[model samples]
Target: MSQDKTILVVGTYDTKDDELNYMSNCIRGQGGQVLSMDVSVLGDPTAPTDYSKHVVAEEGGSSIEAAIDSGDENTAMQIMAHGASMLALRLYREGKIDGVVVLGGTMGTDLALDVCQALPLGVPKYVVSTVSFSQLLPPERLAADIQMILWAGGLYGLNSVCKSSLSQAAGAVLGAARAVEKPKGDRPLIGMTSFGKTILRYMITLKPALEERGFEVAVFHATGMGGRAFESLAAEGSFACAMDFATQEVGNHIFGGLSAGADRLTNAGATATPQIVAPACYDLVDLVGWKPVPEQMGDKPAHDHNRLLKAVVLSASERRDVALAHAEKLSGAKGPTTFIMPKGGCNEWDRPGADLHDAAGLAAFVSAIEDAMPDNVDYVPLDCHINDAQFCETVLSIFDGWLENGVVKA
Candidate 1:
């Protein structure tokens, strides 16, 4: 059930007619507006379509179907994603859509998430899938907002037990849509990520710099979704600017870790707007538990940054690959964009007594970035270390310039 409050039901009408209708009826029976959008990947249905989306209700609102005839697979996929997003957005604007419910095995879940993910974060997006029971990412990777994954083996067509399951799912999403209270604020949102080493830089300098400039910052820890989040918010228009301060996700993303959350590290940076970036945590990847540093890592070197945080020192080649990926993403950075580097240390842990500190690794990271990056960006090197007072000041000054005067502060 939707943890928040109003319920919206979504599904593919062509294949799952009996099931989608059953869930819609259940939601309506409980006093929720069943905003059912028919996604016809097969052929057009008779349901009352939303706009030019080729959807219509057959026996009035009781049965829904697709309106289009046979089409190419890729074309159909694009249509489903577009139509799903449109339906959700329309409902969202009218204040009717609260929580969204989606059903199907693979294509069904994919189409549903297309719409569900379009909903806001606090809003619940629930999907009952068959293929997803094995690994959640295969399907969930498509979801943008908060999602609930339930593996019902395979709920392809309608049946007695399947109907019962869909009914309950519908009940949940409806309850949530009606109750969630959207937070109200006028703060200009900016998304950021920080780690223990550089949390001070965010709290001490960057946050204030933006807040003083009238931007409200939303900071996420540089765990895994760190860089991804900062950039995603920028894409959703949630943030005025994204300060990917602690780009720790890059290590997890490139090195194979469960934390990167399935997508590219900086998918959002591929879009417009200038984003400030640095090798915040280009040090290495952390393993689950140091049980002899695994096998392939082989006598290379390691750093156990406590009992939990185990980082494998990245090799020069790996560092170059990461730098290339990062550069490719930021090559799309428009307006006033700058890649800042600190000659000293990128993180506090890189200084004196920190366990994971590796000067050679940090240097390799810098060299990789410098070499792999295109000539389009303005790369600056600060003489002081990352946490040094002057370096922090320089970052803030540059940020102010981007926000106001236009390029290179002080």
Candidate 2:
């Protein structure tokens, strides 16, 4: 509904021509500009695309002829997905598009996932997929801010039921682009990760302190999805500095639990985003309500974090393995990095006399980190709990020094 807004409409134009055209018209009727990207690998699109399937394939490093000659649908899909992602990201960075909308059942949604992730945050992304919100989808496959709508009655052809969903998705993406405020220019963004309210006591002190020092702090929760978003953004070089505490997802990843992904702790280092890493909640791994604890971890102390969330304590070996894994990842940092160990305890459940308390396990983690840390990486151990005021002060003090030394911009 905005005159100046531009939306990138993407789909397998060879098959869903009618639906894609209808959606494009709806977007145009709502006063939004459209840039259609056709990801068709088999046949030609019924309607003209601003970026054709062949062009997309070329951008992705393959020729449409090669894809067609091979006669492999999966290979063609992969090529088109990569090309569309490359073109979409180029258009976005060049200011040619402000939002993206893609329609598909399976192939289209897969392609949409690639394109949506290519675009940065604040560029609204919407997906109309028949498989919307299916539990079978992995967290790594879905973009953090993508809005998906179930494509009811949109399996083969467009119908009245399908039109209803299509019309709403068209309007919502345009509306979001118009309503979302443009970020103020070039301010340094600091990313901080936190667990839930259990650790909110000390986490609340961070934003204000960082803001006072003239940095914008974005705090992401340490849930599986939250960790994915944080690391994804970090990999994109979205932050001037990073504080990756609440690292339960790292342990969860190693143990095949509710992990962000296997690559969670590796991005900030890869991107060289000056980061301070901590082992917050590294003593616990998450389990879903519907699933029973794995037999290997059944004997560990467990607690219900909420109705659908379960937290299981890890053994000393588990903690040591987690710490070693993290040390291996941090050792690869190309930028300034610090690993802070809170000696008193890492989590609320790990404090003295708590149900999950294990001093030996905590000690194992610290010892592993100390032994495996690379020479360039700073390992700072504090004699305080993770949530202690002293730990908070120590974190801020280290960050401040980085600021003064120009390791991070304020």
> Over the stretch 1-410, how does candidate 1's per-residue lDDT look in tens digits?
33233566666666766777777788878876666666654554456533223432231221223323323554455566666676676677787766677776666666665666676666767886765444444422444344454645335566676666677777767766665565454775666666764323644677777678777777776555444445445566565556666666666766664265544434445444556666666666666553557676756566666776676766777777777777776776654457778877777666756765767766777888888676767788877667778776877777777767643222
Error of 2 at 275 (Å): 1.0
Deviation from native of the Cα of residue 253 in model 1, angstroms: 3.5
For model 2, the local distance difference test gives: 0.87
Pairs of residues clashing in candidate 2: none
lDDT measured at residue 86 in model 2 versus the true structure, 0 to 100:
95
Which ranges of candidate 1 are over 4 A from the true structure? 1-6, 13-22, 40-79, 94-96, 120-124, 131-140, 153-168, 181-185, 196-201, 258-271, 286-295, 298-310, 371-373, 384-391, 406-410
Q: Write the per-residue lDDT of candidate 2 for residues 214-262, one digit (tens) a residue.
A: 8888888887899999988899888899999878898999897788888
Report the number of the highest-lDDT candidate.
Answer: 2
TM-score of 2: 0.95
